[model samples]
Target: MLKKNLLAIALLLCISSVFGQEMRNCGTMEVDARLLTEDPGYALNQAQIEEFTQTYKSSETGATRTVITIPVVVHIVYNNASENISDAAVLSQIEILNEDFRKLNSDAGSVPALFSGVAADVEIEFCLASVDPDGNPTTGITRTSTSKTSFSTTDLMKYNTYGHAAWDRDSYLNMWSCDLSSGLLGYAQFPGGPAATDGVVIDYNYFGGPAYAASPFNLGRSATHEVGHWLNLRHIWGDASCGTDYVSDTPTHNTANYGCPNYPHYSTCSGSPVEMTMNYMDYTDDACMYMFSDGQKDRMQALFAPGGSRESLLSSEGCGGGVAPTCDVPGSTSTTGITETEATLNWGSVAGSVGYNVRGRQVGTATWTEGYTTGTSINFTGLIADTDYEWQVQTDCGGGDLSAYISSILFTTSGGAATCTDIQEPNSSTGTAGTISTGVTYNALIANSSDVDFYKFTTTSPNTKIRVTMTSLPADYDMQLLNQKGKKKGTSQNGGTSDESIVWNVNSSGTRYVYVYGYGGAYDVADCYELIVEVSNSSWRTDGSELLVERVLDNAIVNIFPNPASNTMQVNYFSVQETEITLNVYDLLGNQVQTLHSQVVQGENLIKVDVNTMAAGLYIVEISNGKSSYTEKFMVE
Candidate 1:
């Protein structure tokens, strides 16, 4: 009995250590365990999946002869603006999935030569759903504003009350991208599970392209890993010591490996087999994990066989080509050469159409002004500055018949002014500087083409780590950290409207400067950005930790209950020290609707605000001490 207890304790320790690393932590096993305990029928379902796997492997004709395409729907639930990722990000994830599953990824050649022969194409494809379950045209992406700060495996985020609910699981692969608490990169549900909760959950930061993707997990491989689990592949280590992953091709691993390990990593398990750290099922960093083995591909294909758990998806018309009759809809529609007052819209030529008609309108307005173009593109000028406009293109097939207008694409015009008076100038070096410290966020803007904002910061002690993040922007911006001698220590220049961030752990204390500038000399007076510079002795945490910073109002505890309130809303907060607090609310259009000032004690306080008259929409609740401020989102219904 004593020996058995010791072994169990050791096993628990091993599992805990594996999860403690800064790597992908999938919760499928835990969710499955919970389901098995609550629903006895789930065991029978899992057993059926296993039986199908075995039978399919033994049958010669069971191998997938043709490619299988899976339809996908992405549900983005966000509390703040940044969490509501862009459509381009979601499309980038789909592109990554297709490349990796078909062995078309550029990194496929990086797979170690020893494992290259067994690297399977898997013959699988993924596409965003063009038609929703209601038989209506859709983009397959749903956005929901939630009061919940973070989601866990309880699947509360899967419901409409808390967030956007899943689509029909039998016909679509439901993917929820939100702020997952803890350091979890993502999680997945295996083939045999309740339909209501059948899907995958990915951390918003790890779901998309490199613009917002963090290091180590930024390659959009988290979804690839989670999807592998959803298709019935287990962890490379089998989640146990020397245990089988049920796939015969992969070598036995003692445990999950974190970061990028050196090649030929030999496991301590029996035979001292060299671990396949490059396998997608392993816990290595995204850039390190690349290929799937033949055995694992067979396992996924088994689920699509007749009478299998996911066989219904084979008949799903969600892939767009089969369900809808062939019509020349505009493709690759995009905008370029955008300025404060004009934009150039472009698209690929539609076959059968001689010319196209373009229409533009403000997003919330009803009227669209139409223009005709003989070529594939058109230019719209005389647009208002600092406003969002939606535009669409219709194919003119000839004889007065025009195809229906494609879905509207949105773009926001830049602020007209090239400069602002509020921001301090000439802070580009330590000599002319605005003082900054750790744990405080500063808001500023680049006023014009020549505008550059800089701040000089000092560390009180040695071996301090600092992280700088630039967000809430109006244009593409980049940042750099320089030492006292003007040598660049780090730089971040993410493209497009994505946020820029940089981290540096200095070994010695000294003066440093941060230089912020607009990309390609672009700047706007009306659009301000926030810079968060955090200095700590401890190592920097994951992106989730940075999100927590957005939650708190600088050392104050604030909570708003019953969000999406129909009547009165209660605001509760704790003042760490005596401070004057101001509360304000704003709408999506940046209009301030309500404001209140309060003198608070050092402890807890509650204030009720009447929101009955407010319209049903998203609102930002901002609480600020005299020195610092924080904001959260709440919905009024």
Candidate 2:
């Protein structure tokens, strides 16, 4: 079903007219005029023209070299059935936009001889938005799935759904691409009139179709025409009968004419002369059109003036000209911090950028230590812990001037030091022998022979996610998350021979339990194990939000007797709880698992919980109160 639509048909004579006939009026004309030039077309009277001229001349005299940047967000509304255009295609279109707007179209040489003389070098550039309206870095393109391929004036609302995902509009230009219902390939709504629909829409066939389709003479020209609308330029043929396109030089045409026509064609208007077939707003094939009259430039620049829609883009405050803090990484934030065991630097690159330099120093030091020609992100190791240090990054833009230095903001290294203040219990069993912070508990077991070990834990939250990493693995072995009574979660190969971890995402909430067992066979001597417990942070209540920290099961000593016990059970603690202890349980679905206990204690203690009345199933024993927690996988068989 992939086939060409009417956009590629032979030129037909179907009464070419303004797509928005009813919507055309003086208000629209005035807005378009105000965008390309300071003077509105309605104000062409001696008074308005003279005033605009004076202001413009004075502004020109004091103007400094400036480049106005507009962020862009592209929304690709496709059927989502075909090969989804890759992200690379989205970026390619952005590149084409920048190249075309700056008059750097790769096909400039291909312009027909009849139009070469009028080819206009529009002085502008575009960039993908570095910051979305929500203030996040985005490549600036979105995609939506739909069954319908053809869009019309009413379909314009789709651009909003596509663009609303952007962080902001005043800061970003939204462009939507889809199949159109008519001969129209693309159209821009121009900014201001309505916030509900404030963006441009282009037909997909005219967007990035191969080279010919991509030519400024083709797909490329659509962007030019739409941007003109974006910048407030009226069509050269105007909107109605003798509707002034506003530029005095463009010979008036009664309606849109297709293909190229010889000069000297007569018009009904007074001074009737040849038509301006080279104007971008004409319906002729892209190769037949060119130029934005000086009058048009005036109108375009007017939009960035005091009363224009894009005036905010012209302010000195809006310009970000300070040196970019250099980094070993291109997209990373630069800041001062402790000398890292591994230090990395990054920054943006221009074509031909050769190498980079890294400089660093201990905190408070006057001189910086330098490193030679390096690429992005350099790692430094063997540094003293608990010390402060700063680093700066610089890039060599080929043989041109060197980029400004980017420095790291102030930061320190502390957690690595043995004497750090945040250090709570160096030993996992410090506070309680068999308890973690809350709703999680851990018990170790030593194998008599060389076999796998089984463990259990519970949670209090409706659902749970249990991940286990070996605090310290036995010599050579492995483990897995096995099928329990509730549900099977996930399993992962441990980092080493005897270590493993798993994460389970579930919809069910409340106390739930989970179980774990070794991979190979039964228990074996010298096979020591340590256990850590965890609960998912998907809870609605914020008070216990921190209860969801990642934990690795460690240690292998104690045991719970009467496997699948009926009532009371013995929890042998290798050590004693000096203060408080917390415990909870959970199901495999990761729901709360369940809360087994919450209380303070002092010394070696063996506590028993009734299970004879408990339903038969798999559960997790989560033990924690405030500071920390432990986890174990158990079952009530």
Candidate 3:
């Protein structure tokens, strides 16, 4: 018996080693799938979540224009001293989140112009909770020491019995940083899941500043990506072959993209479209992925809309103000002459200020090396190459009390050499136009902020719809559509790392021109934008019948009602033809509690389920026609 037990343990260890070797792994899907199999109620909750999201997206009044601030509580579960990350590292992650979500990251300029128009300022902010759950002042960070060297999706790290328990999840976004057993970087529970474990779990090594974080995954993007899932965003690839991530703006990816990929990496899926490797939802390295699409922002913002799963966080006091300050906030900060090891930082001169206290540090480092500058500009030296750094300025008002430090700005040192080669010139007008077709993709560098590129194409037939898209790198680029006479027919000029797109349907078969220019004359030699012009003759209609067809194909119009039921629940379903169906109920552990075999005729069918004797927790109801399946979740009272 002892020998057999030893053999079993060895085999388990071997299996873990094999599965944990991947460089990047997210346990969200695994955990979610387990929940769907065990807890029958999770299905209904997810359906309601989808319905709420759809309602918010369709209602003009439900649009979330204002910024929503979420209170964050970081729980550090460390087995050793080094695992207890520093406050500076924690602060750096918070700052990075603020920048990335608001489209203020220093690398925002690197997004290709083709995708920049869809990039969004999520208008969401995160701040450390100033008060604990007990109404006491807190730093919004907690630490717990454990004997376990590692953890997995069993959530041992989330409970106080083993490591740390979450705070009030409804009022705070709980983030637990720990040493995960596998190579898993992180995972998050989507909205509508159990509240006790409702938050994001990040591997401690991948959670914070550079001093402790590992390379390739070190820029604090792991938390950014996981938080995205917590806010209801799915993988850009939809976690399946040619899957739909449910966001229209993001291009369909066949699978995850790891590391940094060159621009215009074409997908092998239908249409052979170019992949968006830089999207945060992809599996790329931290420094590689930078932007989120507008559609993704809409989905995230829906959680804060009224009647949404996370709406309660809207009233949280986690970010309540502190004591008033005497000094004014600094403004108008800028960086210039950036190189591999040096950068020049400048800020607006503050009134009543005698001297400025400047502090700078490599991103993810704990301590800020300080410098005193009497003038408006200061030159920083001894910086690392291709590294991200942040600096802040404070006013010294002569007395002992100095003004508060203003918001920090981020800058990245130049990479030693550039590998870009797609440089094009003399394509600014019809005479010098670069010939392009509907299906082919072209690449070019703006060279500088002042540079612009032009291309010309001829329509083969009347009633053709032309689409011109430009994606830029490290700068904002805009596009304009012009007729053969050089008259501007349409333009798209979204700000930040968003892409620019211009579509025009013409009745006449003639030559047309496309003008691509940088926004605010911004450009970079190392980064290039991709341009794809697609011309199609298909009739363009405004009616939304196409979208309806897509929905019906995805699901057979199944509905469940009287959720949080006390006695009975109704399942109403529609099918085009008569089919045999099976209904099953599951618990949270993925165990089948009950099953019913039934048949449905063409059109609508109603089936009633009695839940009076069921347990008072979440349950899942899964209906299958042997060909397809639909699941919903509900609660028993």
Q: Per-candidate TM vs. native?
A: 0.49, 0.40, 0.51
Supply the TM-score for candidate 3: 0.51
RMSD of each: 17.1, 24.9, 26.0
Give the per-residue lDDT digits (tens) of candidate 1, residues 315-419.
997767544424467899899998988999999998888798899886434357899988988998988677677788988888876666776688988767643
lDDT of 2 by residue, 252-311 (tens): 776665655565455665556567665666666566555555556555665566655666
- True-vs-predicted CA distance for residue 372, candidate 1, Å: 50
Question: Could you tell me how far off, in angstroms, the CA of residue 183 lies in candidate 3 after the best superposition?
Answer: 0.4
Task: List runs of model 2 lying over 4 Å from the truth.
Answer: 1-65, 82-88, 106-120, 147-149, 155-167, 212-217, 263-268, 314-637
- For TM-score, candidate 1 versus 2, the one ahead is 1
**Considering summed lDDT, which 10 consecutive residues are worst modelled in model 1?**
1-10
For all candidates in order, the CA lDDT equals 0.75, 0.47, 0.73
Each candidate's number of clashing pairs is 0, 116, 37
Which candidate wins on TM-score?
A: 3
